[model samples]
Target: MFYWLLKYVVLGPVLKCLFRPDVTGLEHVPATGPVILACNHLSFSDSIFTPLIVKRKVTFVAKAEYFTGKGIKGWLMRQFFVGTGTIPVDRSGGKAARAALDTQLRVLLAGSIAGIYPEGTRSPDGRLYRGKTGVARLALESGAPVVPVALLNTDEIQPTGKLIPKIKRVRLRFGAPLDFCRYSGSVGDRFVERAVTDEIMYELMTLTGREYVDVYAASLKTSVEAPRPAAGAFEPLEDRAR
Candidate 1:
């Protein structure tokens, strides 16, 4: 009830008229059944825009911080996300991964589309990063097909740290559903999972045309913290001494 109300009444008309997003390959999405919408996350609005264009109800695992903020704006944001059928997920590693996957598995088991960003977080540099194996695990465990969705130019409208979005057109390209029925999970045969994950990311790369990085999105944080020489610093002690 609330989903329809928001989609048809509140936001649907406005968003449709404003951004006028070009959605392609929507027919590739199964009319009904459990499936995974694996997408490349570009901006905060990726969550909102993707669902708006799709005809069926698509649920995503949103960051828990969006639900647990302070004050009135936070309250409204939480309500909106909840109304849209998003599940709050803790981004912490290990135990949190298990818990979040538990929720996603339940959603898939219930025969609904579970939207996931295989890269696990928004692309800080707009390049597709290596996907985590969790997406493959869910698809394999749930026996659901994976659909690769590429969102284009959404970041141009609303980038990270920008409170308001600029009026700009966006494009959403949905690739054909990827079938991974060939590989059976066997003892010590973890390569299947890696192969499945790599296949999905490769399709996403082709659709989005972004440079592929072999590193996981989470590892980029460490890259930022690694030591860097100061600007214009000499490369060697001899040069500094001179």
Candidate 2:
């Protein structure tokens, strides 16, 4: 109810008016049934604008901190995420990571759309980073088609640490759904999962036309102590990942 109200009546109108998102290839998304929207994470607004454009409700897993903060700001953040169809999960790996995967699997098996950022975290630079295998696991386990989605220019609208977004036109593209049913029984296989993850990342690279960085975005964040990448220091795709 709140989701509908926010999308159609309250926040949707305001966002549509301000950003005027230009979306394409929406027909690629199936009208019903479970599906995975594997997207490249560029900015915080990727979450906001994706649900706004897609007709069906998109369920995304956000870091647990977003739901566990203190004060009124925390309450507001929690409400916003919930209303936007986001659930909180501990992104810290190990048991917590498995739990998060289980949560999303439930959502998918229940015949709902699950939006996943395969890159694990937002790109520090504009370049697309290597994807995490969680998306592959979800697709293989759920047997849902994976749709490669690219949200262009969202970073400019709401870059990291920017409270207010600048008024900018957002563009979104949805590619044809990828079927990995060939690897149906290979969910737990690390090599198969890596291949699936790479395939999804390749589609994202083609869709967004961004440079491909084989390193995980989270690792780069730790090295620099921030999300900003050092200029001209990325590895060549052929020389690095291969």
Model 1, C-alpha of 57: deviation from truth (Å): 0.8
Q: Candidate 1, residues 72-180: lDDT per residue as tens digits? A: 9899889889989998888887888778888888988999899999999887667778998889888888888999998867767787778799887777899999977
Clashing pairs in 2: none
Can you tell me which runs of candidate 2 are displaced by over 4 Å? Answer: 225-242
TM-score of each: 0.89, 0.92
Please state the error at residue 31 of candidate 1 in Å.
0.4
Candidate 2: residue 240 lDDT (0-100): 37
Point out the worst 10-residue segment of candidate 1 by lDDT. Answer: 227-236
What is the C-alpha local distance difference test score of candidate 2?
0.87
* Superposed Cα RMSD, model 1: 8.7
